[model samples]
Target: MLAIPVLAAVITIAWAADADIYLESIDKKFFNSLNKIESIFKTWFPKFSFSTEYHIENYQINSLNNESYGLLYSGGLDSLSSYIKHKKETLSLISIWGADIPLNKTKFWDKVKYKVTQLAEMDDIKCYFIKTNVREMMNENLLNKTYLEGEDTNWWLSVSHGLILTSLTSLLPIKTLIMPSSMDENEKVPHGSDLFKFMDYRWADSSLIYDCNLSRHEKIKYLLRGNTQYYQFLRVCYTQFQDYNCGMCEKCLRTITGLLIEGIDPNKCNFKVKNGFLDLIKYYLSNNIILLHSEIAAWEDIQNNIPEESSIEFSFGLKNLILMIIIIKRTIKKEYF
Candidate 1:
């Protein structure tokens, strides 16, 4: 039996659920391949270096033989895109709480669970909900600290999220785990990308990273081809976890921007984008909060896709300059005070 131990939510969830994990038939060659791939990905990021102190604990390996398979669905664009692509297949949809969504807040989680379950049932897919306290165990400030101080962009998810997802398969009854790609092949990074997904799932019978072929904007375009009804069910906002979208947060605004660029009405899809939306985009740029790299790329695509004569025009010129001056003044005042 072989197992690679890591700190992950899946381990905690399995312990909480008393999940039986079997590893006697584990493929040693596949496990080594996963480790080697992980090492190669580590080399991509200058700040990241693979730690060699981790060990395989005997207790972490239990026994299970169920052939169930599914994905870690969050009702977001990437996962939803993958869901639509594989809707016809017999698969289970697993949702985890205590990661992005708080574990104890029943008001928000209950609503999300209900909505997700309905979405699954509509497609005749089995839905499983797992609640965990893994986030509570770690210090958020420390977790947010970049691998190399002042050098690397904060990759909070990349550092440990792949292990968490991979661990879920080993601990649960899931044999095959399909994770949606967060970025396209062009902007490949070490964290949460297809490279990480391919390297992390050594224990599963089949572990695949889906949709590396499409960019974030392209995924939205593909998703729009499907029944647009699922658009209303998207829970992209992390600011207000209880609500579907707050419309003001960076995430909500980014999604709204993409949807609008794709000629889709955000309001019709249940996302309300108020007036002065361009000003908001400027504020984001001034604050250095550009959401995701793909988002920036998507914005450029939006500009290119729309005809120049179209009434809906987007420009990031004067507003951003004015906002930057205001922000600089505010920062100087706070520093002096």
Candidate 2:
């Protein structure tokens, strides 16, 4: 007679265990600061919450005598920069499922992961692949958009991914998890800001944001000094359905531009520059001012490195200007029509 109730209780307990991750006591001052930061984030989207099963109390924090390092690697430029610069100390390369890469798109994940795994192996680092249903669970079983969706839907993964990655450090003996900063110190707070990493450092297992002093452009310059072959596996394209960069997407163009300005051909890498990619590059520069402006800054920095007369057309011509005007007109018409 009591079997049904007993079974239900067992299932409930298992579900909670799976959903929540208990952590050591967090500092009271740090805990209060974390709450304030979270409150500010909540202002952007009131419906979204960063709260999870992160335990904080007055208990003493423990530390191992031997220090180990891990990094949150996504095979993207920022993470790749962090991984490569700190390759000597990085014992673990952690990649999460359904963060930016979609779980349903196994083809993309498989191909990217295979290449990244090979890169990790070359450096003798243990690559850890973690699969989670976090994204699907947050999608709310709807064909519609979630709270995190905005101008660029993929910027933030709805949850505090920094927190998620730090929480996992509890399972390991890692003393520090190096997280790559995506934006410059001067730029406005984007979706996944360094603030989250700072909070994770205080609350979750010890983690530090790597080289926030430099911008994306500066990182590419640092990468230029390293073996280009090491970064050939860098995968920045998210819109394309393939393993290789389509070379026309915003991310691809932005990254390829960085390489081009440095006198490196995108084709030599995993990026397959689309037909008339130069025209598309000009289009993005003229239209997407904010993103392209940063790329231009990178270009200016490497102007001396560029050959006097290179095949790559890093210029804005009259033809590109006309196309930009036409695109704007069409966009306006569509909006009003």
The clash tally of candidate 1 reads 4
What candidate 1 gets wrong by more than 4 Å, as runs, is 1-34, 44-68, 143-146, 149-152, 185-189, 197-200, 276-279, 282-295, 307-337
TM-score of 2: 0.67
Q: What is the TM-score of each candidate against the true structure?
A: 0.72, 0.67
TM-score (C-alpha) between model 1 and the true structure: 0.72
**What root-mean-square deviation over C-alphas does model 2 reach?**
8.8
RMSD for each of the candidates: 8.2, 8.8
lDDT of 2 by residue, 1-337 (tens): 1121222122212222333424444444334544555555555454343444444334444344436787877887788777778877746888877767778889888987898799877877787786755455433323114344444333233235544444444445566767776554333233434556445334333445544555666667776435676657777777866756777776786677667555455666687764476667556555654343344444344333434443444332223323433443444234322
Worst ten-residue run, lDDT, model 1?
313-322
lDDT of residue 310 for candidate 2 = 39
Candidate 1 residue-wise lDDT, 1-337, digit = tens? 3344333433322322334444434345344545565566556545443433323333323344557668878888777887877777667888888767877678889888898898987877798887767667755455346342332334345555655555545556666667776554434334544455354445524455444556666777776534677876777788876567788877687677667655566775567666666667667666667546554554454343443333432332222323433443443234322
Candidate 2: lDDT of 99? 69
On lDDT, the candidate that comes out on top is 1
